[model samples]
Target: MANPDECDTMIVGLGAMGSAALHHLASRGVKVLGVDRFVTPHIHGSTHGRTRIIREAYYEHPCYVPIVQRAYELWAALEKEIGERLFVQTGGLMIGPPEGELFAGALRSATEHGLAHTILEPAEVQARFPGFRVPRGSLALHEPRAGLLLPERCVEAHLALARRAGATIRTGITVTGWTADDGVRIATDAGELRARTLILAAGPWLPALVPDLDLPLNVERQLFHWFEPASHPEWYDAAHSPISLIEYADARFFATFPDVGHGVKAGIHHEGAVIDIDAPRAPASAAEGVEMQALLARYLPQAAGRIVDRATCVYTNTPDHDFLLDRHPAHPNVIIASPCSGHGFKFASAIGEILADLATTGETSFDLGPFAISRFQAPAT
Candidate 1:
């Protein structure tokens, strides 16, 4: 942040949204300065997981379907621009009881969107995939166009392209505070910078930056464990295996990825310790390891070899598990987005465009009403 007042757009947190916003804004010929406390792709936030799930038929809500649709386009365009593979099409399976959230959500979204999906019985799933064994009453909705997103690479590609497109990306600097007087003035440890607009995609740090907003963003420390496949590593490779989400019990779900560089990354998405982003992640516990062991032994028996590695990431979640993307109710020049509610990485590219659009034109073509701040607005005393 050389000159706080000199920037046309100062974007904080360059991991996913910030990087995307910088690239999009730079491409649109905006003088933008993208700042991050740590250099993005640096494994300090939620976006550092080696891979993130990217399912098209969003069971969380139908509103997310279109956002993901645009995200797919942006990711494809990004892959073309960077010449690096970001998404892998390994059909996705969401398994649960027919009336469970996983099943009902998938069914609702699939029916609403007319997506190509098939509901299969537990035995049918086992017979077809041969890689999975579900409980007797469980079923699966198969979405063919779903897979994983390489998180670090995606961020790197976005930032690299943004720099090439003339966006100044600064890292190793922390924004102490900011204000929107006329445009926006940001005070960082590095220096002061100014922008016509500001975007707060600061993930876990959102509440810290805008304490007045009283945002209900809880940063949970989530873990991903990888294991060497006991059998059929080839089929478990990126080519053959499908990314899986299994809901064995009520509100208990875990997502799994195929063998990437390390091994098979599997973890429970919503279950983890609530963390403050600045603090180090809580150490993995023996009890948690035992739980994962039981989970794998039952849900994913074939590849239950041994735990090879584990890593932690953050999940900034809203109360309803939806995203929060809206301009400041008080400061028009400031746009606040805390969308990565464990499901946001896939939408980063499009979110970058959405942020860029909101910053530049005050609106976007994508329907973001579901993420509006009014949903979290306070009640009168």
Candidate 2:
């Protein structure tokens, strides 16, 4: 009959989104408690890799432009506040056919938002960026604001700032279950705790937390590889090379980043195996490596070199490949924020502020119509 530990708000999962929320909430002087099953900047979740692409002209939809714009401002402010380098501007190119999803979507957003961009022909792309061998009919949409964000460092900065702002963060603690009546009562392996509001940002383990929702969430196993340049090493340098996304064939796409200390980093988007969160994650196999090398040989020939390192990460994807940022349909006090698909790291900064706004004021200024959980709700007869 012990009284449960209490707080104004409790956040589960301390990855990119969770850490940002902690920083924002704690800065507002809210008594917030954040718990993570692993260390804050661990490599198990979706936000580990050294670099994540941050682009202004979102190819997915035009609605993302404003939020990402906000993210840029916040990222710069965070770097200044923490005195840490988190973002690098290498520009970016979306290469594909004029009508392809990558190119057309990026163009649509750029045109809609009046973003600074240019459409480059095949010869232009090849001449300006020697590392790429774009096909004759393909084109490239060059956006100056697109670049790389250092995810691990960003998470570390957020956690550090949150701690300094008086937020209590507990690592290595697993949340078993939670109940919501007047408030939220979370049961963990250590003990039980109570909170006036609960924010569930559990990335891949989100489904396990709310099994009753039966969300159509898929966890995919992804691979990231860094390779030494075999030739024209200068073409792969950060200054010389721009973060590029190639729609090599139809919907199949792969993205690359210039060498930032590590070898040139590359990965195929959404071309990963669906997996369970608890299952043992397998490393990039020989076949996978060969596939990636072949890709490089075809498009980025000079980057086809010795594979220096490989890593595995998971992407918790939603059906529409959009974000899931909404409240639990059954519990108003419980908010669900995960299922970022594969392209969510870039928006974690703004999303953290959005989540904080939602948790504190029950609403946010950003248009979250596309990310609502009710979209998955069945229609009534």
Candidate 3:
């Protein structure tokens, strides 16, 4: 007789990735169980900023283009399946010096993939978009297929669909520990649960769950600020303004979103204080607000207005800023996925399918070389 608590697969952390995994597995008729320390679609994790950019011409790497393309299809399918709007096509602009990594890399990816894009001079950018004040030497790469994804709604839709497909979801319960000696035994704050396979997608809390691996993961404290438009509010409208990233200096970037009822959202990327996962998050300070406002004042002067609201979030970063997705070295039944390095929310839909494939069939059609954990492992002694 099968134990009532036993499931085909058990997943810890029902954030963007885990929730999508649950939906995929359940749709395939797998008896899956998902647990999260907080409620789904909550503000505690990385998926609650209201909007996340989804772009086809990935400046980070050309390899991501295919996966992100697939992600676009999957996100649209999910929207149709659930009957809710999850994405918005506002287009996007990657602005930087011609020789800089942001513009050059985006151009390379667009050229390589044959994506529809146009290279614009500073004058062209300023003329076409009144919201931006691009520097004289900088250029813009405009891609039409880039826009925002409603992250909280996506999570809710995925979890709701998973539940409708017979998956068991437990929230407000933390997974304290797990062992894989005989099947996978998950020790949670609520109680103990067993499953044939275990997946660890706990985001910042992932390190605590797999301490033995000594994984190279760092949690960084990040801030998101929304500000009221100082002038020309029409320039910050969804139809007129495009999501944009400016590489102000070498390897330094910040992003902005059009005011979607709340306020104009903006934040610096990849440069935040290193923090422990368990430490209390400090609120965004006034000095930090000044710093961001200074940037906006120089680039998009109208956006540097009164601060309406601010929120804090953490990024689980790997040393190289790549994702970690692989099975445990010693335990084949266990899979590890997290440390997205702050730029992974857009790809959650495709990654969830990849995780489902890894958990069930132990393989996927997508290339996992760049995301493998072995790159961080030491040479055999």
Candidate 4:
């Protein structure tokens, strides 16, 4: 029998990915143990934002289409199992120039995957969603399946279900260090624990956890703001509007969410300044709020109201801006699963299942080739 402090699999970081992993592993009857530095569903990490966008026609890559599709199924299953409303399908619009990466990529993925989507002109955009006004010559891809996910609730439900499935969960316990020899040895601030395999899903803290590998992970500071619609609040409601990703300028993007009672949320996609993971996150400054308000004035003038609420989060980015989900090169028993590049929250459900599959069976059906760590390494000279 395994010791009380030991388990078949140990997962560090109970944030979005880690929490889902714990739930999936435990559900499969795996003796899994999960640890986190602070209480999960907290605002300290990237998962705390009240809402995150979920879309099927992935503009990032077509490879993400299948993974996200699987995530949709798992998310519904999770909601049913836990009796919680985790996802809201408000549809989604990918707005940008016809040849821009945002619209072109989304169209490519939708066509490649045979996903149902409609292309709309600026007039149609205004006719269908009055709150938004796209620039002339620009276009929008309307995907019926895209929506938003309540992240904190999703993490809470996953952890709750994991505990119910006999998984051991320890909050406020920090993993100081870890090793992988015959098996896996985890050294925590509390004490030491052992597991047959280990999963590193620490998000921004993942790089420090495996210093020997010198993982090239950049922790960027991102901000999110909520505003009361300046006019026609009903036009920005979920019923009237859909989650939108607008590329207002060449290669620049921002996302907007319909008001879900807390005001309409908006955030720039990837213009954040890179920062130290341990640095105290500065609150949204007046200048930052003004910048966001100005941006909204152009595409979503109705959502350019006073900033009722604002918060900051971090994104661990890889150089290629894709996820890094694979086993450690030197330690096969250890899996590194983070660096989601700001857009990973929606896929946490499917990623959790992939992590659980890797931890238990050493493989998964999903093709993770593009996300492998080796993609960053150079060929041996």
Candidate 5:
């Protein structure tokens, strides 16, 4: 391994966030080097899920509204720049008990952000989305700006554009370790990399990179299953079906993608098992499908099936379930980003922009208060 002596920035992950950061920085003519263990669009990280929810009226919190709106613009811009279909606008629905988090949270965000939404009773919901059958006493909040993001395609486009922007992107090269010397020296599988600043967006491997931070980032095992629709396939199609999140007496998680070739893909966000990145991620098990089936059987039985396919991915999460996007306490040149708590892919583009602003200008326009590391200090581990 030889050292080139210097670079402007070195990104430790080439997944969604890292790739977007690389593109933004590289586009600015910054000499950036991005390293990833595997070529992106691979299933190893959190970005490979076939379909991710993109909703404007954020049920998670209202603070995310500004960043997510920026993300939509970027996503559309990316689709045009790459000349590929990256997103499908099928609108979005949050279905649950009228008082459950799904409906109430959506309503809260809707009111705060002044988002356009519809309060629909179960009968109205079923009439509009025959594929979904909410509980007898449930309600649904429909947001038209919400839809679906093609994860693999988005990653591919971002990296392709990043490399085109003159960033030195190195895949198949894993970072062994990094530390603050004069600047930052990163040891990788292929060579030693030196950069004036370092960005650790290593998702699941973030804690391992900075054990001193004591980040309570749990790598949860999330499973995605593509099932054969029992009936009304067209009704569940992207044009006709809205990406929906259901919170019934049983459990809660969003579902979507209108039969994008494979089928309607779905998963429960927070119902994943705690896992270590080094250990083998559990393969999609029958027991896992059972839980999903239980939800479907109660809510939308027509969507359940002999799962044609399933895959495992990881989400690096904080205790508060927000992101830990902050500069290193001791080494300010180093930054950390794990903006996913089972639900963050929608803001990948905005996150990219924020990382670039922090890397180049030391600040961002968005209110990152909800995502700061201090929010996790007390129970981060």
Candidate 6:
């Protein structure tokens, strides 16, 4: 039996990645404990958004294709395990000029992986979905197996299953600091505990927790808005419309989701203010809403309606915008997972399994070369 004060593995931050990790580790019969400062599925962090996009033909890199594919399978299995619908299959569209990064990257991944997709010109896009006004020079890459994940429910399900599997969970407690000797010792606001392994999955709070590493993690404030359709409401439904990432301007992109209860959701990607996580976030400005409405007026004109709701979230981005998943350089028993670069929620299910594999075996089959911490380290003189 595991001691109440200690466990085989301790996961910090019960958001998307941490909750999933706890579930996977517990399901494997490993004695694990998950601690979070706030009750999970809360709006305080990055995981509270109602809808998150999940796509297979990844534009980031071909290497992520397999990982996301596995995530899709695991997501389906999770739905089966919980007997609830978590994923909504609305398909997905990558729209931009043929030579632009958005469209080209999606096409490359599709071709390399032989994923089923279609290339639709602007005229075809408008004809198929009258709600859209695809730019004159833009094309869209449509893939069948892309959609949105119910983020809050996903986190809730993971934590529920983890508890059912005998994993210990503590919320409303903060980890102040940690030290490693014979094993890992975590100091929290309530008390201290020890674990053989520690996984730091705290999204934006990661850099502060591991000050020795001096990680180059940037926390950016992002906003997502839900607007009631101004016209052709049926055309914006999941059956007629797919979640889309559109490169409206050169090297600038925004994502749009079909109405799933609240309203048609959309957000500009990665253009938010870089903020200090500890500081109070500035409220979304009227100018920001006007900018978004203007974009919609040009592209998704039908979705340009009165704002039903809006929320702020943060993305802990790395310099390269890729993920950072690896063990601590000096402490092999310690693993660091800062996967949220605005595109990581979908992979949380699979990343949890990888974190479990690393915790138990110290290695994973997934090639984590691109995510290695050494990539950011200075070369030896």
* Clash count per candidate: 5, 0, 0, 0, 1, 0
lDDT of 2 by residue, 311-342 (tens): 99999999999899998988988999983899
lDDT of 4: 0.92
Per-candidate TM vs. native? 0.97, 0.98, 0.97, 0.98, 0.95, 0.98
Model 2 residue 13 CA deviation (Å) reads: 0.1
Q: What are the RMSD figures for all models against the true structure?
A: 1.5, 1.8, 1.4, 1.1, 2.4, 1.0
After superposition, candidate 6 runs with Cα above 4 Å error? none
Per-residue lDDT tens digits of candidate 6, residues 1-381? 357568999999999999999999999999999999999989878997689999988888899999999999999999999999999998898999999989999999999999999999988988888888888888999999999999999999999999999999999989999999769999999899899999999999999899998889999999988889998899888778899999888889999989888889899999999999989998778888888888877888988899888889999999999999999999999999999899999999999999999999999999999999998888789
Work out how many backbone clashes candidate 4 has: 0
Across residues 1-381, which tens digit of lDDT does each residue of candidate 1 receive?
Answer: 344348788888988888999999999989898888886787678888689899987888888888888899999999999999999889899999988988889889889989899888988887877778889888899999899999889989999998898888778888888888787888888777778899998888888888778888898888888888788777567787889888878978998898877888789878787877787677677677667766876866767677888877888999999999999988989999999778898899999999999999998998888898878887667
Lowest-sum lDDT 10-residue window in model 6:
1-10
lDDT of 3 at 187: 91
The residue-by-residue lDDT of candidate 4 on 13-123, one tens digit each, is 999999999999999999999999999888877887789999999999999998999999999999999998999889999999999999999999999999999999999
Tell me the lDDT of model 5 at 7: 81
* Model 6 score (lDDT): 0.92
Per-residue lDDT of candidate 3, residues 1-381 (tens digit)? 135369989989999899999999999999999989999888776778788888988888898899899899999999999999899899999999998999999999999999999999988888998888899889999999999999899999999999999999888899988889758988988889999889999998898999888998999888899989899988987788899999999889999988887888999997899987676788999999999988877777897799999998888999988889899888888999893788888899999898899989999898889998899889899
Report the poorest 10 consecutive residues by lDDT, candidate 2.
Answer: 1-10
